[model samples]
Target: MAGVIQEFKEFAVKGNVVDMAIGIIIGASFTTIVKSLVDDIFMPIVGLLTGGVDFTDFFITLKGAGEYPTLAAARAAGAVTINLGLFINACIAFLIVAWIMFMVVKAMNRLQRKAEAGTADVPPPRQEVLLEEIRDALVRNSTRP
Candidate 1:
């Protein structure tokens, strides 16, 4: 039990694990912001451009025999609906997240490349230089048949 507890502590406190947990928390918050952007901002503009057509009202009623003004109404009426608008909203949010993540990875990769390139000017160890000289001397002596 003590060994298990110690192992758990080590695993939980690892930099990678801690970073992942922080990423997950931030991702959850970002999702909320994205949802609001899609639902409150983008959807409203889209609706206006399409002549006041509320996309959230776009649904297929599979087991109800009436029209619904909104998703809440459909649910309150106990209607079985496949909400296409919600799916569209989710798709938009996913695209936003994916694009942002791609940009972040691109920037990180560029920085990494620059850092690697900067190290190219560094000199090798003296031990390696001496070893190479010895090898060259041996090769020169052997070749003098």
Candidate 2:
């Protein structure tokens, strides 16, 4: 138990674990922002482009209640619905988020490559004095023989 606790403590103190935790927290927050951007900004524009059809309210009730027309009504009456519009909205949001992440990662990779190329520290070629002396001795021996 003590060994396990000590190992956990060491792992927690490591920079990589802390960095990963921070990244996860930031990613969760970023996801909220992305969701808002999609729902508030993009969805409205899309709705306008598609002649003001609201995607959130669009649903096909499997069991039709003739008097209750709205999706909320069908949902309230325990009617099963295929929410295709909401699914489309979700897919669009997912694609947008995926594109944004791709751009961010692409830029990061570009910068990383540039930084690595700029600061490359290849060791200088090696030369051994003893090896040179050995070569010279061989040459001398060959000439004598």
Candidate 3:
């Protein structure tokens, strides 16, 4: 039991675990922000361009007899509907998030490459230099004998 508990503690405290937890929390928050941007900001502009269509209220009633002006009306009247507009909105939000993540990963990769390039030109350690010199001396002495 103690070994299990210790192992759990170690796993919980690992940098990767902590980082993943933070990433999940931040991702949730980012999703909320992106949803708002899609529903509130982008949708409004799109609606204007398309002559004031409300995407959230757009739906096709599959069953029940009567016209529903909006999704809420359809729900209130107990009409089954296929909310294609809502699905479109969700797709747009997903694309926005994907694009932003792609840009972020690209930037990170570029920075990492620059860091690697900077480190590549560094000289070898003094220990390695001394070891190589010793090896060369031994080789020279062996050849003379």
Lowest summed lDDT over 10 consecutive residues: which window, candidate 3?
64-73
List model 2 lDDT by residue over 48-109, tens digit each.
Answer: 99999888878887776564566788788888889887897788878988998999999999
- Taken over the whole model, the C-alpha lDDT of each candidate is 0.92, 0.85, 0.95
Every model's TM-score: 0.80, 0.74, 0.83
* Best-to-worst ranking by TM-score: 3, 1, 2
TM-score-better candidate, 1 vs 2 = 1
13, model 2: CA deviation in Å? 2.7
lDDT of 1 by residue, 1-145 (tens): 9999999999999999989999999999989998999899999999999999888888888888688788889899999999998888889889988999999999999999999999987888999999999999999999997
- Indicate the worst ten consecutive residues by lDDT in candidate 1: 63-72
RMSD value for candidate 3: 3.5
In the predicted model 1, the residue pairs found to clash are none
Model 3 lDDT, full chain set: 0.95
Alpha-carbon RMSD of each model: 5.0, 6.2, 3.5
Candidate scoring better on TM-score of 1 and 3:
3
